[model samples]
Target: MKTLKFKPLVLALSVGMYTVVETSTNASPIVGAELRIVLSEQYRSMIEEDVEEDVEEDVEDDVEDDVEDDVEDDVEDDVEDDIPMDTQDNLVDAFEDQIIMSLDELLEDSDGESTYSDDWLVLADDEQLNALEQQGYSIISTEALKGLGSNLVKLKAPSSFNISKDNPSLALIDSIADVNHVYQLAGRFEPPNGTSFHYNQLLPALSSQQLRLGMIDTSISLEHETLSGANIKLHNVAKEQYSQVKDHGTAVASIMIGQKDGFTGLLPTAQLWSASVFFEHKQQAKITTAEYLVKAIDWMIAENVDVVNMSLAGPPNAVLEQTVQKACDNNLIIVAAAGNQGPNSKPLYPAAYECVLAVTATDQKHKVYRRAARGDHIDIAAFGVNLLHANAT
Candidate 1:
């Protein structure tokens, strides 16, 4: 088994799923670049039309006001139109198949990963969904986002642009459909460089025995040598049919509480409630969802955990927003990955949420991680470039 080590935000997992765990001695740091958006030839042709239209409009607008607002507005509008967001547009179907994830070449500094779904999710009860399904609408999946009531329903429908023309009744379902968006791990593995903030200085100044830290990520390895004697308790919030990965979750947990001769956690003796939400779906590439997030956070709050660390990011959803706010209402401190999508990418949530403290990755020299997302949402930077990752045999 070859073990690899990386900082909290990103985890390297096989496409097929759960990876074996071991301490990696020769883990190579892979420098992460912003995800380049490489449009397929056909997709490019379609985008070209829209791009030209936007350019022409910009030219006209610039002619009218070549000053402050024009430049700022164009830059902002161009970004919003380019990056993958809510997919209720003419390009909805194309976005699902047209987008692919690769490094800089195809990377447009996108949301890190170009993931989107065509399913339309809305606030509806089971009876309401059943009525729609009976009337010929396609009901795909459904989930009850705990405190949000049993109102979330996933529907397979046409894009919003065609909804009124093709499925007129769907218009009455909701005003704005929350397209089922997917999120990915927030960081990448890179060669060890730059110095990280040492916990040694703060260790003596604080009482760690009582700090209860809750982590929401993949499954963890209790047997990891670094975690020997650690006070860690884990639970699986993922559905029974799904499988969980441990590499990313263990790395984060080790950082939170693992204790060893050389590697000591932030709070070595602190109690931890490790909630694993990363689960592999049979039909979808996503390992988790907004619903899973709500469940995990609710579990943490029930356990009365003081602080929560989320090493992942994705598209924002209302259920997730409500749950996160609930945590804040409980007076819990939340810190999450600021995202490694690059300097130009949009802020990823729950890190982008106002109540959460967004932390980005940095190298030993304190330089920003090459792929770290930048925006007003970012609150702090930490040493994330240098890490000892794992590879399981």
Candidate 2:
């Protein structure tokens, strides 16, 4: 299997990486520390060309060997000052070993690697609730998951614990990972509310050409020029923050319903019920949680959207799978991104789920996109390259 391996620690004398993010293949994420920063040969060539004068003394010592002695001062110094931005590893390595980085900062990057958290979610009930008390675990959060004709508790574990097969970074080997609720459905299952989603009578009658679709992505810009006067209703499903949205949703919404001269969306007259689940992270791009996704899907179901678009890629979750199946049982059609992790990467969900149509990216020439994930689940292809579309900004 193709695995991402970590290098040895740089080992500064005074400080060390207080937290570590370990990279493993098909196992839960582990925290690691003291990332090593290798001084490539280019360090010498660059200094030889750019050095006008040293701060106090010449950088005459070999970049690697002699500098090892003064690593505390030379290496411990904010790394960006000594090294060029283009050459450094990812954001994690550009710091002193002693620095206690926040989870967001440490996870800000990997080496051309999209960063991920090792956090895992477990299904528990009041009797099985292994939810760590705020006093013990690193962090804890809970959500109500409606699945399999019963209510289950979704518990979020800290980075130290993780589970699931799709996100190889997590493992269910921990003791807590085993203390999950195991229930068997007794009688023939009926389903949620014992009914399928039907169009709302309150909604205006639609023409034959009009369709009902749902957008489960970032927030949409209803006022964007392309989307003006379009039948798009946005529901912010974030639990806390009331006003948090981004541009990705706007771009996607434009592609679905926006109609202007020389440009037209696939369903220009479609009635879109958009559920904005993503919120602006403290530092990262807009981020959403599995809970948000479940809530969004539930909202879409209530809205009676015939089809929904999930433009996201990530590890699979049991609750999410259950909710998706529920949606499928309601006769809702789910479409998802085929993922950009390359052909060799593992399948991402909900695209990988049997209930969804995994939509892969192609170009005007019908060639598969260079990074579009290839898998048996990919049921369709769409134009993914080089076209003028609406921008949020």
Candidate 3:
């Protein structure tokens, strides 16, 4: 077997390439910029059209029933009563699909790998999935169908890599490689020349752990002195649409695990899991789609991770909620941002889930972030407002 190395987010299952999609958003002031209206419109059309089709189908069914019952005292006149019920069911169905699709689209992309031709792929085992996800690969939509008259599972495009057949040694490499270990990244610890109090407080603990960090935003620098002591892992889950320059993940990681010299993170012992899952540099994509997130969480659980931090949010999602719940049940401390879409205080997933620890950011002024989501879902608050960290500097 030829020696080949696997990237952080895209695993090398075979001599192939992959096209991944992920969620992306802008920084504090640019949050709205990340919400691509056109993308949303396409998605909304896809959804509304589906609902309309369902309503028409339901109406026809109602018509048939009414005709059958007409002899029993004008049952046709009672269709109004069923209208409301039909509408409610349709609405619920639409909402569910929207949630699912939003997550899927955010995690997938229109771009594919240069060497391979497949448009999609999925990891089968928990171990493989986690290896991909922590580096920021989330599933959008996938088909795992039972074969004709057989119990065997057949995955759709980008079938799970056949490590044994395609590149068996790659699998062996992952099993033996320590890249998954945080300490391996070389430039992760050194902070920028001009550091802040936050970085000063956090850097040492991370260095002592020998762990590296990965950030998915543009604010942090891969060459910064502080991060120099650590490794700088980057990913473009959104393809060329995004800059691969933003450092939202970097800033957030710095807050949670950034080294000293100036800024400090919550858990200094943890290393960075740097990945950029966005496109067009400023569009909203699901950084870690629900499917990939499940795998990522599982990986963290298996590794017995000390903490998993997420500084992003979106509407409530069932699969995501369940995954976080399972992670917590397994004793992994999951942390998430309270979402910058707040002030109106709608609920956000992971952060709002019962098992997660939701944190809201506060600025230097000690005031809550204007967009930080609020409501009963918010469990705790952190100094997120205009806060400086090693990644930001």
- Best-fitting candidate, measured by lDDT? 1
Q: In candidate 1, what are the lDDT values of residues 1-393, reduced to their tens digit?
A: 111122222121110011112335332100012223333345645664665566567576445544544555666567667766644243544453435321111111123433233445555656666667766766666666444334566666543322334434644543223444455666554443443333333223133456777788878787777665878889888764446777777766665565665556556777888888876654444356665677788778778877777878877765467668867778666778877777898778988888787777655466776777788877666656544333211
Q: Across residues 1-393, which tens digit of lDDT does each residue of candidate 2 receive? A: 111111010010000000011111121100121122222344443443333234224544645544644643554355558766656533322332223223343231122212222233443443334434422443345555443232333333433332332233222211123112111100011112212111111111223347787878777777677788799888888754334664556656655666665455555677888888776555444566666677788777777877787777666556577778888888777777767667797887777888776767654466876667787887665555443345564
Off by over 4 Å in 2: 1-208, 239-243, 282-284
Q: Following a full C-alpha superposition, what root-mean-square deviation does model 1 have from the true structure?
A: 16.3
Each model's lDDT: 0.57, 0.50, 0.39
Better of 1 and 2 by TM-score: 1
Residue-by-residue lDDT tens digits, candidate 3, 235-309: 333344224434444445444454544343444554555444432312232233333344455555555454555
TM agreement with the true structure for every prediction: 0.58, 0.54, 0.45
Better of 1 and 3 by TM-score: 1
Candidate 3 lDDT score relative to the true structure: 0.39
